[model samples]
Target: MSARDAPRPRVHVVHAHSEADSFVTAMKNVIVAEFRDTGHQVTVSDLHAKNFNPVASPRDFLERSDASRLVYPLEQRHGYATGTLAADIHEEIEPVLAADLLVFTFPVYWFGAPAILKGWFDRVLLSGVCYGGKRVYGRGGLAGKRAFSAFSLGAKEGMFGADGIHGELVTGMMRHLFQGTMGYVGLDVVQPFGGYNVPYIAQDKREGLLDELRAVVRNLDDRPVLAVPDLDDFSEKLLPLHENPAVS
Candidate 1:
């Protein structure tokens, strides 16, 4: 069905950028505005502005499973089950849990996402709530959801690729995010939108990128999706269930 004829999505944007006036923020704003204009419900978590605590520590759990020792993942299970996660983490998780589409906005630093955004993956994707034991990949809690990323970087697009100076961006440089984190937890990962050479490029070129980004967001659901693991073809020991089993 066409986007106009389809049901509106619940979009949750996690914006990670230090400067208030940065291009990262602009991309985040544009993505959010486009979704809202299309009658989608949009929720934003501006990490820097909110002073989100990115560090994962014992303090995250208001009531630990083992008060004597701190096991972060174990405690995550406990916290989520008991509704004892820290106020800030819980607040951000609400929108994430409610979202049909999760849009991550940040600038690539050191060929990776900023530390704050990385920390979001660590802290918010609770072991029990999102994934645990056999509940991962295609069987994960968020199996039906989708994730999209819109990031700005200083380098040109040519600098990345299989043989480029920086290698691949989505499946290569940030494979951990695309596959391990997002896809691992069962979100169908979308091929990301990159604002390449923004800092060194001309204003006209930057505007062109923004226009491209807006179109991406407007036609967000139609974007290409990356393949992730499908557990139905795997045994409990993670072996192929069939000789012809496909590995995504």
Candidate 2:
């Protein structure tokens, strides 16, 4: 089938903004609209609006394996196998499992994802289902999917670079999210689209930023993909080809 005629992706957007009318939230709306307009199916999980719990604790499991003490990963494993994960976690995972594309929308908080979004990762990306052991990076359980980030920052774009004052926004400040978490889980990472100086930018510029994001969602397939380790370059046991080169 022609590229245009091919089926569009099923998109799952995890939005982290708290304000309903904020520009960051507007960017999320644009993503939903563009995907839907292009014949894609879109689902959204508005973290703050849903009052999603960002804390991961014994409460995450409906029934703990050990009532006396909580071993998080073990409980997560038990939870997935026993269908005991909390209701909200299951609800969020459903869309993540069904989606072809995952979009993260948020305002940068302390050069990282908002606490809630980080909690989503902690609670939703189930250990057994999304990853474990050798199932990480290229071999991760979520390998077939793609992930994109649309974020806004209070600082200017130029301040972020390998040598810039902030020193590498995506690869540095936010690396924990895009790389450590998303890439570690095997999603094909896309170059991020950031709205810089968001708090200080004028109204027209904010609108233009939305327009840029609109085009980004519309042409998501054309966006550059970021680099991550491929299992092919490693051994069957996740070690490097040269005597298990992967850093232990």
Candidate 3:
């Protein structure tokens, strides 16, 4: 079907920031607005506002597979199979299942997502449901869905390059967030929107960043997705048969 004749895409934004006035929040708002203007259905999971629990413990499962031994992944696999996962987890999963596009907006904490957002990945992206066994990489449960990350860093752009103190923002995040989390679950990961030195930048520059973010959101469907290795390229033990090129 032609793009115009297709159904409106369902977009879910998981906004992880304590302060509503933060630059990250503004970036999220820009995304939501742009998507809405383009006729996409949008849903925002405001983690902090909803007081989401970031810690993953026994509370996530209603009935554990083993009463004494608590192996989280096994329990997740069992809970998802049995439909006995916690109410909160089920609540979060609904929006994720309905989404055609998922966007995460947060401020980088120690070169990674904030703890709350990390917890969302831990608790909501369940094993049997989102992935398990052969359901990973390109063959993952959520394959064909698209995802993007919009985040800000405390360090300047220069500090994230090859020879800088932080060393390559995209490369570092590829290991932790993009390839590890989103791509692991089969989402077609899009290039991230990184706002560097957000806290230290001037007012005009920050506003310019917001404008750039709006443009990114508006053109999301046209953007090139990051290339991930197909499952067929791996062996039975899941080792790559050929050398994988660096993401940089």
- What is the alpha-carbon RMSD of candidate 3 to the true structure? 3.7
Q: For each predicted model, how many residue pairs clash, with residues at least 3 apart or on different chains?
A: 0, 3, 1
TM-score of each: 0.92, 0.92, 0.92
List CA RMSD, all candidates.
3.3, 2.5, 3.7
**Across residues 20-136, which tens digit of lDDT does each residue of candidate 1 receive?**
788999888888888888788889999998998889999998887799988899999889889999999899888999999899999988878899999998999999888888888
lDDT of model 2 at position 77 = 89
The C-alpha lDDT values of all candidates are 0.88, 0.89, 0.88
| Top lDDT model | 2
Pairs with steric clashes in candidate 2: 161-168, 240-244, 240-245
- Model 3 TM-score? 0.92
Model 1 backbone overlap count: 0
lDDT by residue (tens digit), candidate 3, 1-248: 99889899899999999898899999999999999988999999999999999889998889998989899989998987888998888889889999999999999997799999999999999887788887888988889899999999888888867788777777664467888889989999999899988999899999999999988887777888877778777765677756653311
lDDT of 2 at 37: 85
Clashing pairs in 3: 160-168
Off by over 4 Å in 2: 1-8, 235-248
Cα lDDT over the full model 1: 0.88
